[model samples]
Target: MDDKMHELEIRIQKLTQVHATDRVRQLISLLIKDIGEKTDASTIRIPCPLTTTDLARMAGTSRETVSHVLQKYKASGKLMIESKIITITDPAFFMR
Candidate 1:
């Protein structure tokens, strides 16, 4: 029952973030929650058993849009994608 309630709370939070935030932030938040795991205090690792199409479907956006936002993050040094894995260097950027 507690697990179910926690899952429901997460679903509500996701809905709130989706409706309240911009596309980029929405995608970022989803990526962190769905694909990422915190390896330490400040770093989040998203291992690549996932694809942009999956992310687009989850984010209710296009594959092209997902790619674009990912590229922007890559360029900004906030995210790193290599060897089919993604690492978020600054998790706090998305927390805001």
Candidate 2:
């Protein structure tokens, strides 16, 4: 990988691990939490919502995989989809 990609990977790994890097760990956590609260819940059926396409991009997974997860989530009564808007029916479902 290029230096920039390598650097980003190292940063991500470090953040995922001990989170000792103050700038990356705490700052990113707060920002992400805020985003989760404000993001539209209809897109992916979760309160931390994302459109399938956007999610595909973010997770480095295919749109099909995202759709599959949504379908499974709906089937398990963890989510509700209406007019392409997904509502998180159970907030603690993922914890299980």
Candidate 3:
């Protein structure tokens, strides 16, 4: 019972931390939770084939927003997207 309450508390905290205006953070959290796997010390790979629409659905946002955030991450060297594969360049960056 205590453990379940703690888990619920953590979940509530995560949901509370995500604001409607912070779509990028929401998307990042969704991606990391859904498909991210630690490949090495500094890298995480999202091997599942996912489209912008899929990401939008998972993140509860629009396809355009997902595309925009992905582009920004690509430009910032935070993530790479190629043929549906997503590789997070710096896993620690998203852990926060």
Off by over 4 Å in 1: 1-21, 30-35, 39-41
Total backbone collisions, model 2: 1
Cα lDDT tens digits for candidate 1, 48-76:
65577776676667778778888888898
**Model 2 misplacement above 4 A:** 1-50
| Stretch of 10 with least lDDT, candidate 3 | 19-28
| Model 2 Cα lDDT, one tens digit per residue, 1-96 | 599799678755644454222322232233243443423553223344457776555444567766777677678876666665556555444322
lDDT of each: 0.72, 0.50, 0.74
Find the candidate with the highest lDDT and give its number: 3
Worst 10 residues of 2 by lDDT: 19-28
Which pairs clash inside model 2? 42-86
Give the TM-score (vs. native) of candidate 3: 0.72
Candidate 3 lDDT (Cα, 0 to 1) = 0.74
| Candidate 2 accuracy as lDDT | 0.50
Candidates ranked by lDDT: 3, 1, 2
lDDT of model number 1: 0.72
Please identify which of the two predictions, 1 or 2, would achieve the higher TM-score against the true structure: 1
Model 3: how far residue 69 lies from native, Å: 0.6
